[model samples]
Target: MSADEDRDATAATPPELETDRELVAIVAVADNGVIGKDGDMPWHIPADLEHFKETTMDHPVIMGRVTYEGILETLGEPLPGRTTVVLTSRNLETPEGAVVAHGLADALEAAETAAREHHDGADRVFVAGGATVYEQLLPAVDRLIVTEVHREPEGDTFFPDWDRETWTETARDEREGFTFAEYVRS
Candidate 1:
């Protein structure tokens, strides 16, 4: 189907729409498309970390189970200033101060509800991911806040390939180790 036809089909069963809400995907991908290795981020770019924090702060962040566990292991808690919604199928217990959903749609719904309640009118739900979560949500993402790492890093995990033609870069900033680019669906 054409893009408009695909969009029309999606619009038939839309998720609950808040007055001014958007679903944004936030990611940092190396030049070779790697986002993780051995269940963790392959690179250590402090500036990118800070950028991630600032961009997603005060919004609900939806991530996969592995990403949630990785954050807990590395940072010692769910991200501070954001409601975390973890997508998992193992029936594992939800982390303290986090919500769990079995699928992406449920997770997004949960995140939206959390944003409404805790963030006080914040309307962005950030898909802060592992590869699977990113791939699954790519089609529905309204905006992308991507940090494009300069080097190609070898890794087992990769960001899903997306159609560049569907998005238009609206902002860019050059940092030391990476370039941050923001894209809105065109």
Candidate 2:
């Protein structure tokens, strides 16, 4: 091809990736929509937790203040090997490593920056939620990595209601009591 043809090809954007950078939400939701009970996951599935860790390994993970606190209770620190961004409307003290955002816009902005600068220029940012955060960020989520638990457990918190038709299932892995599902917007 000619020089002009080469230049044109180089300038053209790839069609496969829908966005320059995607915002991803990762969560485990039971069949009845329960995600948590009193700030903690109602069901303890070690495999699901491992799935969460591997999928979000080097990305920036965003969550609500309460969710961050809940994580602190369990792990005693912000999640390791990833940037932690906490979104809250109130004045709260987080550990040294966590980034705090006062609103959704700030949270998203922080998440993107962290993904680029901190995680070896990652192309995706992750949202780890506590129901409210999930609800607020659903519209902007480009992809979802969900662990769909087969059984319904009692809980006070629930995952947000999302329109399934808007998403196309890209992959699925069936585990013993749960299925790891991935979806991208259609």
Residue pairs that clash (backbone atoms under 3 angstroms), model 2: none
lDDT of 1 by residue, 106-153 (tens): 787788788888888687888888887876677677888999998888
For model 1 the TM-score comes to 0.88
lDDT of 2 by residue, 1-186 (tens): 111332221122223212346878899999999999988999889988888898889888989988999989989999999889998877877776589998777777787788778888898888899887777667667888999999989999998877787789999999898999999888
Winner by TM-score: 1
Give each prediction's root-mean-square deviation over alpha carbons. Answer: 4.2, 10.1
List lDDT for all candidates, in order: 0.81, 0.81
In candidate 1, clashing pairs total: 0
For lDDT, the strongest prediction is 1
lDDT of 2 at 63: 95
Q: Which stretches in model 2 have alpha-carbon errors above 4 Å?
A: 1-20
